[model samples]
Target: MKKRKIFFVTGARSEYDIMHPVLEQLQDSGEIDLQLVVTGAHLSETFGKTVRNIERDGFKIADRIYNLLSTEDKVGRIAGLGSQVTALAHTFNREKPDIIVVVGDREEAISVSLTAAYLSIPVAHLAGGDIANDGNIDNSVRYAATKFAHIHFTFLEQHAQVLKMLGEDEYRIFNTGNPALDKFIHCPRMEKKAVQPLIEFNIQDEPYIVLIQHPIITEVENAGDQIKETLEAVIASGLKCFVNYPNSDAGNFAIIENINAYATKYPDVFHLFKNLDRVNYINLLRYASCLIGNSSSGILEAPSIGLPVVNIGSRQRDRYSAGNVIYTGYDREEITAAIKKSVFDEKYRAEVKAIRNPYGNGDSASRISDVLKTIALDDKLIYKNITYKVF
Candidate 1:
C-alpha cells in the first residue's frame, strides 16, 4: 500500500513542543510518511538552538528554512513570514505531501497555511477556534489560518462551535483538546530529586511560582515596564520565582532585558533559565505554587495539572481560560493581589483544585492521528466550500 505523505511545519519551540506528540503518532503509525519541516525560532541562536531539542527527540527533519531575522521587531516578523512562504513554496513543489499539519497562532503557522492554501494542499490546523481579544496580530493570523485550514482540531467544543460560526464545515472540525497536555495525561510528575539536576538554581523548601511572561507585539513599547510590574509583584508575594524566557516574538528583547536586570538584583530569590527540557518544564508547573504569565500555557496547560495561574496583561486576553486562572491588569498592585490570592487564599485554591479543565482529555494527538491515517486525499479536500450557517 502506498503511504500518504503528511508534512508538518514547526516554527517556534513552543509550537514544536505542543505538536511533537502528533508527529510521533504519525511517524509511529505505518499508514503515513512523516515529513518534518523546521523553521523560524528553531534556527535562531537567541532562541537557544531549540531545533537541537527536536533533534534530541529523534525525529528526522526533512527540511530547515532559516527565515527568522536576527531582529525580533514587527518588520522582521513580516519579512520572516514572506521568507517562509517562498522557502515552503520550493519545498512543497519539490515534495508535494498529501496534507500539511500546523499548530497554534504563530506567524510561521500562518505562513505555512497560506502557502499550502495557495498550493492546493490540504491543511490541518490544531488549536484553532480560540481567540485572544488583545491587540496581538496573532488574533488576525490565527483566524486567517483557520479560514484556510481544511481540518480544524480545536481544544474545546466551544472552539469548534466558533469555527463553525466562522463558516467552517461541522464535519471537518474536531474538538480533540490541547495536544500539549497529552504527555501529562498518565505520566507521573517528576519528583523534586529528578528535576533538581535539570536546573542551575536550588529549589528551596519555600514555595515558589513559575513566571513565563511574553511581550504582546501591539504593546511592545511597554513590555519592559510590564515585566517589571510582574517581577515586583512576584517579589511582593515573598515566593521564589522561576523565570522562563519569553518566546522568540518581536518584542521579546525588552522582556529579556528586564528579566536580566531583575536577576542581578535578587539572585537569591529569582532563578532564571533559558529553556527547560519538556519533562523538567512540566515538573516545574506540576509543583509550582502558582503560574504567573501572559503565556497560553497558563490558560491551556495549567488547569490539567490543577495548577493555579495568575495571568497578567492582555497578551492572552479574552482567550478561553479555566477556573484555575485569575485575570489581572499589568499594574503591580493588581498582579500582586492576584498572586497572593492564587497562593495564600485557601478557599480560592480549593475552588481551583476542584474545577474540571474545559480542554478535552489529553489524547488529542491520537485523535488527530487517527483522522489523518484514513482521511481522503483527493481533489475534493483541496477545493473547500464555505459551509454557510444561518446565524
Candidate 2:
C-alpha cells in the first residue's frame, strides 16, 4: 500500500502550537507521510526562532521557505504573500502531496491555500468560519480560503454553520474542535521549579497575570497608545505581569518599542518573553490569576484551564466568548478595572470557573487524522462544488 502524503504548512508559533499534535498523530499512523513546511515568524530570530521548537520535538522539516519580510508594513505584507505564493507553487510542483493542510487565517495559510487552489491540489483548512470583526485582514482572507478549500475543520458548531452558509458542502465540513486544546488536555503541567529556570524571572509568591496583546492590523496606528494603556493598567494593578511580545504584524514595531520601554522602566513587575515552549506557556496560564490580552489564547485556551481572562479591545471581537472573558475598551481605567474584577471579584470569578470552553474535547487531532486517513484524493474531492441556497 502506498503511503498517503499530506503537506502541512505552518507560518507562526501560534498555528504551529495547535498543529503539533495532528502532525504527531499522522506520523505515528505509519500510513501517512507528513511533509512539514516551516516558514513565517518561526524562522525569525525576533520571534524566538520557534522553528527550533519544532526541531526539538524531533520532526524533520521538509522545507523552510523564506517567505517573511523584515518589514511589517502594508506593502511588506503584500510582498510576503507574493513570495509565499511563488515558493509554494514551486514546492507543490516539486513535491506533489495528496493534500495540503492549512490552519487559521494568517497570510501564510491564505497564500498557501490560494496557491494550492491554482495548482489543483486539495486544500484542507482548519479553524475556518470564525469571525474577527476588528477589521483585521484575516477575516476576509479566511473566508476566501474557505471558498477555495476542499475540506473545512471548524472548532465549534457555530463556525460550521457559518461555513455552510458560505457555500461549502456540509458533507466536507467537520467540527473537529480546536487542535490547540489537545496539548493542554494531554500534557502534564510543568513543575514550578522546572518552569522557574526556563523563564527570565522567578515566579512570585503573589499571583500574576499572563499578558499577550497584539496590534490590530486595522488599528495599526493606535498600536502604541493601546500598549501604553495596557502597560499602565498592569502597573497600577500592582500585580506581577508575565508578558509576551506582540506578533509580526503591520504595527508591531510600535508594540515592540512599548514593550522594550516597559521592561526598562518596570523591570521587576513585568517579565517579558519572546517565546515560551508550549508546556511552560500552558503552565503559566495554569497558574496565572487571570489571562489578560486581545490574544485568542485567552479566548480559546485559558477557559479550559479555568482561568479568568480580561480581553482588551476588539481584536478578537466576534470569536465566541466564554463566561471567563471580560471584554473591555483600550482605556487604562477599563483595563485596570477588568483585571481587578477578574482577580478579586468573587462572583465574577465563580462565573468564570464554572464556564466551559466552547472549542472542543481533547481528541481533535485524532479526529482530524482519521478524516485524513480515509479521505479520497481524486478529482471529485479536489474540485469544490459551491452549495447554493435560496434564503
Which candidate has the highest TM-score of all?
Answer: 2
**lDDT tens per residue, model 2, 74-137:** 7888898898889989999889988999998898768888999999998999989998778888
Please report how far candidate 2 places residue 109 from its true position, in Å.
2.0
| Alpha-carbon TM-score of each model against the true structure | 0.97, 0.97
As for candidate 1, its clashing pairs are none
Instruction: Give the residue spans of candidate 2 off by over 4 A.
Output: 389-391
lDDT of all the models against the reference? 0.85, 0.87
Worst 10 residues of 1 by lDDT: 184-193
lDDT of 2 at 30: 84
